[model samples]
Target: MNGLLRFSRGVDWVNAQVGKYIIWLILASTVVSGVNAVVRKLFNMSSNAFLEVQWYLFAAAFLVAAGYTLLHQEHVKIDVLSSRLSKRGQIWVDIIGFTFFLTPICLAILWYGIPFFLQGWRSGEMSNNAGGLVRWPVYAMIPLGFTLLMLQGWSELIKRIAFLQGRIEDPTAKRAEKSAEEELAESIRRLAEAEADAGKKAD
Candidate 1:
């Protein structure tokens, strides 16, 4: 059990690093997109290649970040009722909710997403858009994303079991998961500021 706990922590740590990478991805994608548009307007030139690359980059960032999001418990939860319950009661709710609702959903993603990606890979599928520039494989992200989400689900299950067994307090069950909305809002704010500053310099 201790070994499992350590392993789960290790997963969390890895996911944290992955989360950082996703942030960088968002930053890079945003930069490329802005530059792409500016270059096309100002220079009367643009790379369909660069524009297409931005889409794939954004998609990759989103798919890869799912696990880290889950690890942080940043995914939305209806905790209104649970918040009013006692620690033990909360634990029961978590156990039941996770078991009945979450587990099946996670497993379904793993089951269906695998074959979905496989079909894409087997068919050598490419972007259907004629003007679309990015042609990197789309099939890889599904399996990769689903697998990471599955790992995160397993980690959550482990922690929930610990809570049930009384090895850990329910109140502190998931202290690591950050809110996705909070992070996104911050990112948007930062981007808006950067855009405003750039506009001022141009004037």
Candidate 2:
């Protein structure tokens, strides 16, 4: 159990790092889309490559961030029924869901996705759209993302079990952590204050 807990922590660390870095992909996608839109509207020019790259970035960010989303417990959930359960009951629900549903679905996706990626890579599959990017990279995300998600599911299972056994605190207890939005808002506020102070000094 101690060994398993260590493994769970390692998994959590991996997903945590992934979550931290994947935010940059979202920013990159936004930049790409904005640039593509500006170029098309202003220059009256565009390439399928430009259009295709936006969705490629989007797909990469969205698919690759699955485990990170799960790790943060940010994934949408129907809490209508489970919200009423006792703490232990809720943990059991998660364990069953992770074991029976989440893991199997991830496995099924990986079983199909790995071959899908392999076929595309072997054939050097390019986009049907002219000047578009190759397809295998996006295809590869399917398996890679699911594999991370599955590992996260196991980590969550370990945490829940350890909690039940009195080896750890409640697994569902959210950490006292501000969300990204909150952090960004705070940073913006500080920047605004700094600019205001600079203006006063200039005066």
Candidate 3:
């Protein structure tokens, strides 16, 4: 169990790093979608292919970033009431909420999404719209996104258990700490620049 938890932590770390690459995809997809909308309105011509590509790109961006978002603890939280609790108290709440609510939903989504994508891929499914801009592989994102989300959920479960038992620190609460020496060095740089300017004015 201990080894498995460490392995999960490793996976989460890698997933978080990979998530950064999805930002470019998100930006490109958004630009394409916006351009498509403007072109359709101005020219009164439809480019169904552009529209389809936008959809696929959007899905790719979201699905790819899902694990990273969870790893960074950037997801929405309903911690209004829970924030006031003690460390042990929060652990209890997390365990209960995850076991009863989060785990089931993530598992179900992953289970259903796999078959959904497979069917679409097997049938070579295409857009039903007449003269649609593009025939997108719409089903690809569903399974991929949900699978990443499921893995993240499992990692969260493991981390929560470790935190409650005081075995390992809560992964989310850690911040990058800097040394006092680094701070002093930065202050010295600033002071030197200021003194140089003052001496130049006095000259």
Give candidate 2's root-mean-square deviation (CA, Å).
3.8
Residue 48 error for model 2, in Å? 1.2
> lDDT: which is higher, 1 or 2?
2
Supply the TM-score for candidate 1. Answer: 0.73
TM-score of each: 0.73, 0.88, 0.75
Q: What lDDT score belongs to each candidate, Candidate 1 first?
A: 0.73, 0.87, 0.72
Pairs of colliding residues, candidate 2:
none
Candidate 1 on 76-144: residue-level lDDT in tens?
A: 877887799987786677667667876787788768877877776676666666566423354567667
Which RMSD does model 1 reach against the true structure?
Answer: 6.2
lDDT of 2 at 198: 100
> What's model 1's lDDT at 78?
70
Worst 10 residues of 2 by lDDT: 179-188
lDDT of model 1, residue 188: 80
Ranking by TM-score: 2, 3, 1
- Candidate 3 per-residue C-alpha lDDT over 49-152 given as tens digits, one digit per residue, 9 for 90 to 100: 78777777887877767776777666787788878988778777767876777778868887887787778778777777765532326566776676676677
